[model samples]
Structures are given as structure tokens and as C-alpha cells.
Target: MSTSPSRVFAARLSGLPVFDPAGDQVGKIRDIVVVLRPGGLPPRVLGLVVEVFGRRSIFLPMTRVTHVDSGQVITTGVVNMRRFEQRPTETLVFGQMLDRQVTVRGTGVVGSVYDVAMEPERSRDWVISRVALQEGSKRFGRKGQTHVVEWRDVEGFAAPDGVQGATHLLAALDEMRPADLANVIHDLPPKRRAEIAAALDDERLADVLEELPEEDQVEILGALDNERAADVLEEMSPDDAADLIAELPPETAEKLLQLMDPEEAEDVRRLMSYEEHTAGGMMTTEPVILPPDATVADALAHVRNVELSPSLAALVYVVRPPLEPPTGRLLGVAHIQRLLREPPSTMVGHVLDSDIEPLRATSSLEDCARHLATYNLVAAPVVDDDGRLVGAVTVDDLLDHLLPENWRDTPGRPANPVRIGGTNPGGSRG
Candidate 1:
């Protein structure tokens, strides 16, 4: 489903018209624009080929557009209509595209890559992925920050110096979360957002969803296939799950739910019962659960077999035996790593910590943070009054509840660098 930046760029420029800034009718387009190719490689145009005086054909840089929509075209303010004249075919607008990598700039506050894209119909070309302004490494020094501008953003091929310098992009992209990625998309140009969305895989899309604004979730989800959408939804917390499902059209929601596992669907439905943002609404039902009498070997086997998040294996929950307690009462807790260190024949109940901290269905953020800090715990199990384990909350999830949106962007601040994909960028400022 993801398209390369070059492909997206080419698609956006094809049908768009070249206009003068004042809503003045200038001329129509003619041919394709090229960016980033070397000498004899390809001449990058901002956009299409336009015939201005109904005679001569001119290369219309996609960047010259003031407004682009299905209804009409508006030209760039930089071009004066009265003095304008047609140019030769060899003229290139995006000269810098010949051999350069430009990163997209984040909006004023959001930390994420900016999308870059050209209008379609101009010519079939690749769209640029979002630009990432990232600081390479602190040890390399802050000056190591660089912009990753994509070819899709090259509406017109001007010299590299002609492009506006986006300064805020690097700090913002550093250590951004999924929600941050979503927020960054909102600040970028529409063409850019579409390009980034088109480039991401299902799992990457899911990661971005966790950071996206709640209001924008459905629209983005609508952009994805039902299978990918369902997969991403399955990865989200129950509270976010309810918010997104509620926003989708009923039929769409139904179809996606059908595609999801029955248990996951049920959990989402249960979370939907409570109002948005409530403890019950936010709690997930996918916590790792094991029986009290199960041996350490059994628990380890369960940990290895079950599809739990990586964070979950660090902290697992032990519940009462289903046979002994039909309702599934909470027994104690065990650290997966700690359990592994013990003998395989050891009983889970014996190794489990009975004094484990637990959360009620209605615990507040403050209560959870304090518990996590006080106990030095990674996560806490949520148990109902009947002593049944329902869900668990990890420190990472709780941090989402505690951290500010742009905490890492603060200047001169040291942060624990976080990584996206499998690459570790090391720690960054909080």
C-alpha cells in the first residue's frame, strides 16, 4: 500500500495547472518536472508543462502553485503575471533535487517527520517521504542535526539555497512517539501527509496512531486497508480503541471488528461501555495472565508462547487457578526474567511476590505513578474487587500519561534517546 516518494511526487504534479498568484488565468501545463537527478540524469520540474500564451510550452514547477484543489488552481505569489514569459524545455525548477536528501520539517510544536508530495496528473513520479530534521547524535554535537528533504516536496526545482530552511524540524523529530508522528502530520501540508501515509507499513502506521490526535484517528484509519486498520487497532489501548471505533462509520467499524479476534473485539466493546478517558476505558484486557499453581517452567513456556508485547515479559501476573476459582482471582505477580533465573521445577506460587501492587478499575494517574515509583515496578496489575486480574499497566504506557507532548524538544536538555524500528538512537531529552 505504500508508494515511494518518487512515485507520489510524480502523481501529484500531473493534472495540476500553473497559475499566477493573483487568481489571474496564466496558462495550462505541458510536461513532467524532475528533481535530484544528476547531469543528464533528469531535469526536475516543480510540476507540469504549461502553454501560457496558447503558443509556447513552459515547464510549470509544482511549487508555483498557490492553491491546489479539484475546483481550480492558484499560482505562486513569487511569480508576477504581467512580466511572465515561457521558458525552454531544458529549464529545471528543482535544481537541488539533482543530488540531495532533504528532511521534512515538523510543525511548530509537534515532533515528527513532515510529509512531502507533488500533485498527480503532472506526470507519473515518486512522491518524497516526509522530511526528518534530526540531530545525528549529541556526542557528534547538536550541530550534527540535519534536514532530510524528500524529492516529493520539490514542487519546482530551484537551487538548493532557494528552498526555505526549516530549522525546528530536527529537535521535534527526535524521540517522537506514534502520537507525536500523528501530530506532526497535522502540521504538514496535505500533499506531504498523504505521501507519508502512503509510505508507511501497517505496523509503522500503528505506531504513529498511538501518537496521533484522537480527532484525526478515523480519517487516517480510513486511509488504511481494513486488514491493516484492524491490526493497528488491535495494538492500541482500549481507551483509544473506543475513541477510534466511535469515529468510524458503523459499517466500517463492523467490518473491521469482524476481522479482529473475537476476544480483542470483545475487550474493545467492554472498554467502550465507559466514558472516554476513564480508568475502565483506558484499561486493556490483553495482560499476560498465568495460574497460581503453574510451575516456573509452565510460566516460562507461556511467556515464550503467548504473543505479549515485549514490555509485558518483563512483568507478568499470576492469577488463581481457573479450576479452584472459577472467576479467576488474582494471586500474585512474577518478573519473567526473575522467574527464568530460578529452577524450572519451582512453583509459580512459591516464586511469585504476594505483596505485589494492584490497581482498582478506577485508579487515578497520580496513584499509578506513585505506585510505580514507590515499588520500582515496570507495571501494575488491575484487579476487580472480586480479586480477578483484568489488565495490566506498564511504565511506558504510564509515561504516556505523564510526559508533556514536546518534553524532549526543550533546549540543552538531556534525554533518554528512544528508537524507532530496530535501530537505537540512544537516549534523548525527556
Candidate 2:
């Protein structure tokens, strides 16, 4: 007996892994590209914007898909690795269709949208079944009432004939995760991409910029004035920021550096000294650090800072006195999980594990990956000859560099292209 095929909500299908018939993972579903039809017919599924190996974006025709499971997808052994480009008629259901002010034919601005519910239609297409609404902003924790309305009752934000693109997309885009937003930006026209980049807040733009390819990074930053460029760089991880700046011409890179906060510039400047192939070259200078005398409460507070990334906040590095910024001599380290298990009043120094040997600035890229894999660590501390904590090589950055260099260009044949003196002559190791 054959079982009925599974249907997934748009919100639930965002990151499902896509695999070929042989069970080989090609990429994951980043977004569904669709074209809205006139009259009452549902939107047609043009293809899928599959993110290959989490590094490259490609388009897969609907005919290529064989199955759609909860955690993964199955494809028919055919896929076009060329980058997916959005045409004027296309609307990305999850990336573009979501978060607009939903208007009911009669209700008039009933609420904001969170997702588009789609059902299988004729000819391997999926049509909108309903508009998923959140009573309040999904960006906030309100978890307001969720209402699903049939497509016929929803009139969209504008009249069908007057609709150009998502007019409300900018507001909805603001609530998207940086990675998701980055994917959307990557598919847009260069001019539109620059416009979106300019509109993002310093912090949001910084996060999204980190997700952009090196060429795009250079393009976006070069388009911005020196001061604005410096502001975004300051908001990015120094290591990532350094990688980007290193790609700029000496004069341009130097001008932006001068515009940055001296303290932050120093961090990027220090990382510039290392070869891109080394651990020091791949590390971030913003890991959480606490004085040897600090209590668990202090370590927790440091991790809670809004500016810290999840990777940087994963572990706390311990150091000696003069610890205002805690970039002193590296003493030991404690995972955030362990800190949470210990008493809040307990001194962090007592909890640090000395057994985890730190990586040197000179350690090779291979050595860094091996260290992280060996210990199953997300990030490893980087120190100099004197054992002072200089920065940390995060797993995320390491994985990106470890991939084949051309992964971005070809079915996998093409890609920093992320951050120093504009790119350090050492290369795009991080």
C-alpha cells in the first residue's frame, strides 16, 4: 500500500535538507520561488532556491523534486547549480510573501502575516491555501492569536493590477534572521541589493553583510561612504571585518580604518598580521572574556550583552587582572553550559578547564579544524607566545574556508569574496 505524500507549511519548509535520489545531500530549501497568476488560480511554483552545501545558492526545477519529507527533501538527480535570479513575476513565498499587512476583502488590515500556507495544485505546483496571520508582530514575543484565511478572502496590500513587488517587504525583511535576509539580498539586482543594505540598521546590516559573498561585500561597502562603511565594520566581528577590509585597495582600506573606533581598529589590525591559512587568521576578536576573580554571574552577564554573537557567547575565556575588557593573559576557559550549572556566586576561575590547550596564532587552518573536531568544540581560543588571549577561531568561519575554494562558482565550482589592511596579503583563509 502506498502512503499519502506529506504536505508542509511554508514556515516549516524553510531549511529542510534537499537530497538527490541517491540520498546524496545537494543543499537545503532556502526559499520557494513562485509566480502569482491572474484571476483565481493559485501561484505557480517556478522552482526552488536551494542553498547548496550552505555556501552556494542554486535553482532546482519542480520536476527535480521527488519527495518532501519533514526533515529532508528528495530530488530527481537533476539540478541547475547556476545562481537563482528572481524575475519581475516571481514572489518568494517564505522570503517575500511573509510579513505583509494582510487585508481581508472586507476586514481591511485584519493583521500582519507570518507565513503563506500552500497546497499542492495541478502540474507539480503549490498554490496558496491561506494567509497565516499573527495577532501582533511576530518580531516581538507576543505569540498573538494566529488566523488562517483562504486565498479568496485576502486582497493583498494593493490591487492585483497595481501590485509591482512587495511594497511592505522592507518592514517584513527587518524581522528576518540575518542569514535568511542575506539569501534574499543575494538574489536581488545589484542596485536593489545596495538599497536594502543601506536601509538596514548598523547592527542588522553588519550581520547581513557577514553573510554576503566577498564580491558583494566589497560592492556594498564600496558603495557606502567611508564613515558608514566603518560603522558597519565596527559592528561586525573584527576577524570578519578584517577579511573584508583586506580586499579593498590600500588607500580605501586605510581611510575606513581611520574612521573606525581606534580600539576596534586595533583588533582588526592585529588579526591582519596573520596569514589567512592560520588559526589566528580565522578567529574573531570578540569572544566573551572574564577576569579570574569574576563570579558566574559576571560571566553570564558578559554573554548576555546584545552585541555578542551566539558563537562568541558559547564559552568564556578566563584571564588575569587588568581585566576590564578581559583580553589579558589567558588562564583557562569554561563553557557557558558549565557556568550555568554552577552557582551564580561561584568564582569563574575555579571552573575553567586548563586541559584544553589553546591554539597559537601560527597554527595552520588544518590544525585549527582538527582541534575543533577533536574536542567537538564550536570555538577555540587563540593566543600569542606569551599566552595572552588575542581572539578565537569559530567553527563557522573555519567551515567556510575549509570548503573547496571554487564552491561558489561552479555546481560547486565557485565563492570571502568576508574581511583586514583591506584583505591581508595572506589571503581569504577565514
Candidate 3:
């Protein structure tokens, strides 16, 4: 069996040089990747989030990494060079873990987790085993001391400590996957949940809000002022944002809609007209589409430019002429694999797989699922009467309807109930 990767405080590697085999300095360590684990064990390090050539950030998988020491990181000399876009399962140390407070397991509130300590494991990878913390003096103007604590030694991240629980909870919660955090929040007391919601940044809050029950959604959205609430909604996926808006008191919903970015609000409003369970309702307004006359290189470039997720990017939809933001008419579809197999000059229209019929906006979830299953496709396009490609119903979103309503809340679930926060742990630098 292979041995697991060694432990290192995230801070220790910050700004460290990444050397390629030939001894060339490739990039500096910008952050570490951590995946929050279930079972209360410390989160394991997945790899390093590195910044290259002074500007772009890309993920360096642990396997590609050869060595990590006090002041340097060594890699296998190869790098993918694709820019890093954080996955739901991953956390970037510097971007998300610093300047926060957390409860030390055996210690009292050891504020702001100033740094994280991680262990590398393969894909079933990641565990945060140590943390650096900062503590301020009671004197209003004094700076806090920083210290290190083992992940196992920190108290739970989210149980209410009455008064400071909300604050401590905020710190620890940053480390959680959005879905898991939402589950934790759903199970918490209403008031406690609201406190956490109010403290969350719009991006993080919007993610959690998407996973929650409507009532919880309403309550949390209520906790924010109209402006903030609208901001959060704007950050959310248009379909989910629209669904939540539909549940709000009409006046509240309208006010928020007005406050949203006009273009984004228009997208959500268009979705609002569809039934929640229909194809249109579950579809995301944004799908990478290209003109039928475009070449394989064009399709590939479009998907890459949009930075679609692995699942969504698997296939690029090809549409007829008016191929602007929302493509005009559905010409057909082309799998990403097909695009790659051909010469760059190959026309996307020539490679089309027109065997499947598009799903109507009113198609039922069952029909959508069947279509995806039959074709072995991850997503099916949704079209309006004019045959314009309005959106797509991804398999993940479709599964939501197929699964039991409270599937996420079941006992012993990998992610049982939501609560996310964590500060860099350590008053002492590594």
C-alpha cells in the first residue's frame, strides 16, 4: 500500500518556491488544498494551490508534487497550466482559511485560526490535522497572540456556545462543503442559523442558501437587508435564485428582483414563469453553446473559456445561426470527446449527434431523466417554443427530484446537517 502524504501547517508553505526537477523556480505556494472530511477527523490536504508567472493560479495535485519542506515545494516538473477554479470539495488556504477564529478542542476559544495543517491523500484524499490560531487581548486596541492547535484538539466547529458560539462557528464553517454546511444549518436552531447567515459573505451565504429548505431559505433571507439579500440572490444560480424568489412574499421578492443586476434578474424572472419541477425550472440558463458553423477548435475554446465544470463541460451544445449569448436555434449536440478526436478545423455542425430530441420547457422530470439515461448524457437541453436553446437540465439537478425529499438529512450521512467555519489556527508561525 502507498503511504499517505506528510503533515505541514498551511502557513509554513506560504510564499515558498516551487522548484521543477531541473531546479527552475516555477511558482510560489499561494495556498493549500483541503477537503473537509466526515467522521470528525481532521481535513486532509489534497495538494497545493499555486500561483504561476506572477498572475494565474492553478491547482497542483498532490501526486504531481514530489516534496514539501519548511521553505520549499518540489514538483514532478510537469504542470497542467489550466487556471484553478475551486471545486465544491476543495478549500484554498489563503483565500478562505485565514483571519478567522475557531474553538480549540481541549482549549478555550482560541480565536482566528490563522493557518491550517494538512495531510495529502489521493482522490479519496484530504484531512486537516492541525491549525494555527490568533487570540486578541481584551484591551480594545491590542493585537492578539497567534498559536497552533491540532485539528483533533479543537472543539466542534458549530455547536452553539450560547454567546460566542455564532462567532466561533463562523470561523470553523469556512472549511465545510456548501451542501454539508447547509445540512448542518438546517438542523440547527432557527435563531442560531440566522446569526450564521447574517455573518456570511454573499458568495458563501448564497451557496448555503441554495441547499436549504424553502422555509429556512425564507428565514435566512429575511435576516439580511434587502440590498444584501438581493446581492446574495444575484450570486446564486439563476434557477435556484428564481425558485427562492417565488416563495418570498411578492413584495419582498419584487424588491429584491429590482435590486439584482438587470441581466441576471431578467434571467431569473424568465425562469420564474416555469413550474418548479419542469425541465425549464431545473435548467440553468447558462450553457456553453456555439454557432453551428463553428469548428471543433471553436467549440473547445468556448467551453474552456466559460470554464464549465467537468460534468457540464463534457458536451458542448451546437445551435443554429443567431448564436449569441442565448443561442438561437438548436442544431444538435457534440460531445467534447468527439471535438477532441477531430482535427481543429473540423466543423462542429458536421460532427453533430442529432439523434436525440430536445426537452420542452414543460417536460416532466421523469421524461428528462429517461432521456438522459437512454442517451447516456449528463445534461439535456431545454428549449422554448421558438426552439431557442434556453438552458440545460444537468443530471445532478435531475437527481434531486428522484431522491427522497429529505435524503440529505438521513442519519449517518457523510454530511449530516450544515455548519461551516474555520480560521487559520496558530498564533505561532510555522
Candidate 4:
């Protein structure tokens, strides 16, 4: 405890790299684990929520921590790889504590919790020692006064009342990827999840919703007003938006579609018309489609769009006139790798890989899978009976349908819990 920092602010600990004794980075700190006590006692620190590779969150008990400073946390090389599940006795410092409304005892000042500080006591156990509060500003366009006081001086942490805002928590997680943010939201209480979801902008919310489980997606979307929900759906990929709408009641789905932009709603409706397990059902209508006359430079520029998923960007669909979905005759596809080798001015049609057949709209899931595997393709075009390109199916789409419905809820296999210095007390159960 003496070697670690005397006081660590919870906000600063967010995303700090955690390493093992040999300098191998195991994960990054996402949140702190603590247990609240009675009689206004400081909450005892249990461990940390470390997001390891693959975005799996695991519990790293304080006992396994060798050093903790501003730069990074050093842990005993032996650690458990089991996913972290919140027990009833545990509370996440970052997820549940930040942005809580509180009051200073014996003082009329009232504010919201922005951050908390942790320090080791005489018993050599880390505990929440201080609370950072920000008062409401009286003047426009200016922040309120900030105060740092002992944990005992705060009155609301023990029994929080009123709705807690997500501003501070969102700030701490501002740089997180959508998938990672989805994971964090998945673990939070439903009410808190709704709060955070409401705070996110439409585009960000759409991305996070796409990564979340279907049930969670429905719940969060249901919480929003009709107009906002329709806007969020419009921000999602047409195929994804269709899938989510399909889960809603028929009336609700129709109402949302009516509220969406005409063009966006048309795309979603077209995707919805296909059978769920067919190639057209799973294909994205927004893949990089281009006219046969386009140059390699144009193809590359379109694929280079930062928003395009890697699999979708792996190939450019070459077609006749009418560049939008349901485009005229499917000419061929220009593989990104081959396009990279050709000169920028060369026409995509000249270098097309037309030998590989395109998938029909009615093709079954198994048929689509075999086509991709046989051709060693990441994505393949889907066409209608008249040979017009309707959409393109990527590997990710197939896997989503192939996996178990609850695959997102499943945890990884357990790993040995042997610490470099000693045996881990928490074992693999963590």
C-alpha cells in the first residue's frame, strides 16, 4: 500500500493500462469495485474491472495488484481470466457512483458527485476516502464551484435519492469504442442503462444498439419517444434497422417507419420483405456500390470511408446504371486487394472478378455460407431474379445468424488463477 499512490482519483483510473510483472499488458482498468458500508463508513475497495483483449471484462482483486500509480497498474503475472459478474454486494465506482446527487453534511451546499478518491487505511485495505462535488452554476456559460471533502461529510452515497445524471460517467467513457460501450451498458441496471442510452447522440446510440443483444435493444428503443426512436433507426444500417423493427409489434414498427426519412424507410422496408434466413434478409443495402465505369481511385475512395465496416469495405460491387440498391444488372465485384494493385485510372469493370457467381435473393443461409467459404470471400453480392444487385452479405451477417440467439451473454472459458508471487485467493470464480 505504501508503494502505491496515496490517493487515486477514480476518474483518472479510467482506461489506464494494467500490466503483469514481466511487463506484458493484460488489460486496461475500466472501473473500480467497492462495497458500501453502514454507519457512513468508507466503502472498501474490492478490485478492478479490467477489460482484457476481446473486450472481455474480468475482476482483478486488489490482492493481485502489486503496484498502482497514475501511469499504469502492475499486477501479479498469475491472474484469472473469467468474466466479471457483479455480485449483489458489489458496486461499480465508475458505472454506479459517478454523477450521483449528494449534499454536504452541516452545510447547505448541494451538488453532484463528479469523482471519488481511494486510499489505503491503517488496515492496509483501500477505501473510498474522498468525494468530489460540483455545485450548480448560477451564471450562464460557466461551470460551478468544485469541492473535495472527506467521504464522511457526504450525506447521499448511503441512500441515493432522485435521478442520477450520466454526464460525468459519459465523459469518463468518451473515448470507448461502440462495442466496448455496449458491454458497459449491458452490465448496468436497466434504469441506468436507459439514462446512458438517452444521453448518447442518435448516431452513437444506433451504433451501440447494433452491438447490444436484441432484448436490450428493444428495451432501450422502447424507452425513447417515437420520433427519437425513428431517428435512431434511420441512423442504423438498413438491414439492422429492419431486424430491430421486425422484433417490435406490427403497429409500432409501422408507426416508426412512417416517421423515418422516405429513402431510409424504403431501404428498411425492402430488407424487411425478404425471409429472415435468406441472403437478401441478412445483406446490407448500403455496401460500396459503383457503376461499371468507375475508376480504381473512385472505388478506393468509397471503401476508404471511415464509417464502413472492414468486411463491407473488402469488396466493391460493380454494376450497370442506377448506383443505389436494386441497381441495374450486376456486372461483377472488384476485390479491394486486386484494386490496390491496378492503376488508379483503370476502370473497375476491366479488373472485375466475375467468375465467382453472385448470391440470389432467395438463397438459403447455408447456401450463402458455402458460397463465401468456397470462394474465400468476406462479402458477396445478392441479386434479384432479373439480375439486379439488391444488397451484399458480409461474413459478420452470416455469423450473427449462425450463432446461438444468446451468444452475446455467454462468457469465455475459465483460466488458471495462479499469481506470480502467490496463489490467488479469488480463484477462477471471479
> Which one wins on TM-score?
4
Better of 1 and 4 by TM-score: 4
TM-score for candidate 4, please give it. Answer: 0.93
Tell me each candidate's TM-score.
0.50, 0.65, 0.59, 0.93
Ranking by TM-score: 4, 2, 3, 1
lDDT of 2 by residue, 9-33 (tens): 6766676777766667777677787
Write candidate 3's Cα lDDT for 195-221 as tens digits: 678778899899899888788899999
After superposition, candidate 1 runs with Cα above 4 Å error:
1-188, 195-199, 225-228, 235-240, 246-259, 275-278, 301-310, 321-327, 404-412, 415-430
- Shift in Å, residue 168, candidate 3: 5.8
lDDT of 4 by residue, 1-430 (tens): 5689889898998999988877778778988999999888999999998877666788888877888977899987666766788887788888889988899999988998889999988888889999999998999999899999999999887664468888899999999899889988888878888889888999999999999999999999999999999999999999999999999999999999999999999999999999999998999999999988899999999999999999999999999989898899999999999999999999999999999889998999999999999999999999999999999999999999888887776654323222433455453323
Better of 2 and 4 by lDDT: 4
- Cα RMSD, model 1: 18.8
Model 1 quality (TM-score): 0.50
Model 2 bad stretches (over 4 Å): 1-83, 86-167, 324-326, 406-430
After TM-score superposition, the amount by which residue 10's alpha carbon in candidate 3 deviates from its true location, in angstroms, is 17
